[model samples]
Target: METLSNLECFARAAATGSFSSAAKQLGLTPSAVSRNVAMLERNLAVRLFHRTTRKLTLTEAGERLADSIRSNLEGLQDAIAEASDQQQEPSGVLKVSMASVFGMDYVLPLLPGFLTAYPKIRIDWQLDNRHVDLVAEGYDAAIGRGSELTPGTISRTLARVRIVAVASPAYMKARRPPASPQDLAGLDLIDMRSTRTGRLVQWMLRDEHGNEAVSPVGERIIFDDPGGLCKAAALGLGAAFVATSHALPYLQRGELIQLLPDWSADGGPISIYYANRRYLPPKTRVFVDYVADAFRDQDLAGRF
Candidate 1:
């Protein structure tokens, strides 16, 4: 057994309290993780964990050792990160999780510039609509749009997102544009099922005087995916309310028209969050900085 690998496996298992979970985090098989821990126990002549079919409990010795080594391991990782950051060139794989629309429309396009600046770094990007657990899933960082961030993660605001109401030109020609939030009651709205709070997303609007009001509109079509909803709106199925960033391209291409132009909703901050800020790997830290700089203008409406 590689002593260092065994030590890392043991520490991760002790911290998470499950061999399988630790194995998953470390990208190792459960059997390999178990063997490593067993080898460490044999070398120390003490059982580390009390095992059962349902769970695992650390022994007294194991608990004490874990506590002692955890800080040391963290310090070592910090030292490595610092050293790597100071190197002349950064080289590594950066694993990132981000929302599908934003990732495709913005982040992916900026990759060429980022790659040119740091040629040695490679990105492993995952785009999904759902929130991801960065640390538990071994992702270096995640970009999310919301004011609420997960606990114990370091986050930095990258941009301000704006939500807007939109519909295709044909749809608007058929139905008059909503003059006020109350006018939505008579219009057909496309609903995103994922945004349902208590069966429907409250159709929120801002009046000319800047006061906000909610009007639940009738749904002609419902979809879970933003792409699908955007497509349906482009086909003149119904009026769709979405982020300006997501709808801008269609609006610019004349595929969709912005509705209630005078009204707008301030979405929470768009931020890049990381699990371990203090000891982030060099690649992740660099990528985070690059992304923040790229979106610093916060002019998504102009880009599309």
Candidate 2:
């Protein structure tokens, strides 16, 4: 275990090019990183890093050692993680990221049941719409649109959501209800912009026969959040396209009315993503499976 820790310290230092950066990633201090590297060097009887006032550089031996141990070290860590997960009840902080609206509207409801099932597990949930680094930021899982997933992670589809055009009764009274996708071009538009790209989300409407229809958009008001877009539509600001999961409550409460029922856009897969499939923690494993089962039971799959 000591050897593995030392090797991990060395690998992190090498990858980040500094003890301070490595320390930050490892939740340790720079002195700890330096000490670990030194301890490893002493055990191996080799100088690993060339130290100077300005910068730290790896020696030839250090580079070779890094190249050799990086993969094996990661594999060993994964093995240890898998082994740890195999022991008893899942009991650790399961850090997760999720889109705000979906988390509150759907995932949040499952929490009470999940906690009842696995009392030992603790959840630290972060609500954000942007893509985050799962490894660097130290999140166990994230629930969001599949398109937001970064590389080096695996995702399971919870459901494919149908993006439907909706508006409040007042908004429709102000302007005629859109008869077809073509009429949408003349209506007041409440658009959702991607925070990552600052671009208006494109629409892909399909009719009952599964045919694509072009709806040229005019953005009278724009928001960077799905909830905000829905709220704007509810406030009778304009017609907005939102996921079924997000609009379900509003639709049920009669705060918003669906338009062009046969015409809808594919919201893509909403998935539960994790950094590693090879070593999923028991808490995360159970939560993902439970969520899938819940969705299936409620028949929310593909609709939500």
TM-score per prediction, in order, is: 0.83, 0.85
Regions of model 2 farther than 4 Å from truth: 12-27, 38-67
Candidate 1 has an lDDT of 0.78
TM-score of 1: 0.83
The clash count of every prediction, one per candidate, is 0, 0
- For candidate 2, write residues 1-304 as lDDT tens digits: 3477688889888876788878866778999989999998998899999999778889999999988986687788778878877775877788888999888878898899999989999889998898776765657788888555565577888888888999998888767778898888788888888877888887889998988985566767988999998898999988888888888888989999999999998878888888655667688788878888998887767457
Stretches > 4 Å off in candidate 1? 1-7, 14-21, 24-29, 41-69, 195-200, 215-220, 297-304
Candidate 1: clashing pairs of residues: none
lDDT of 1 by residue, 1-304 (tens): 3367788888888877889988987879999999999999999889999999989889999999888887777777678767766764767778888878889988898899899998999888998867776755667889877625555478888777677788899888967778876676677888876532436555467766978877455666887667777889999888877878788789889999887788877766788898755767667778888887777655543443
For residue 222, what is the lDDT in candidate 2? 84
lDDT of each: 0.78, 0.83
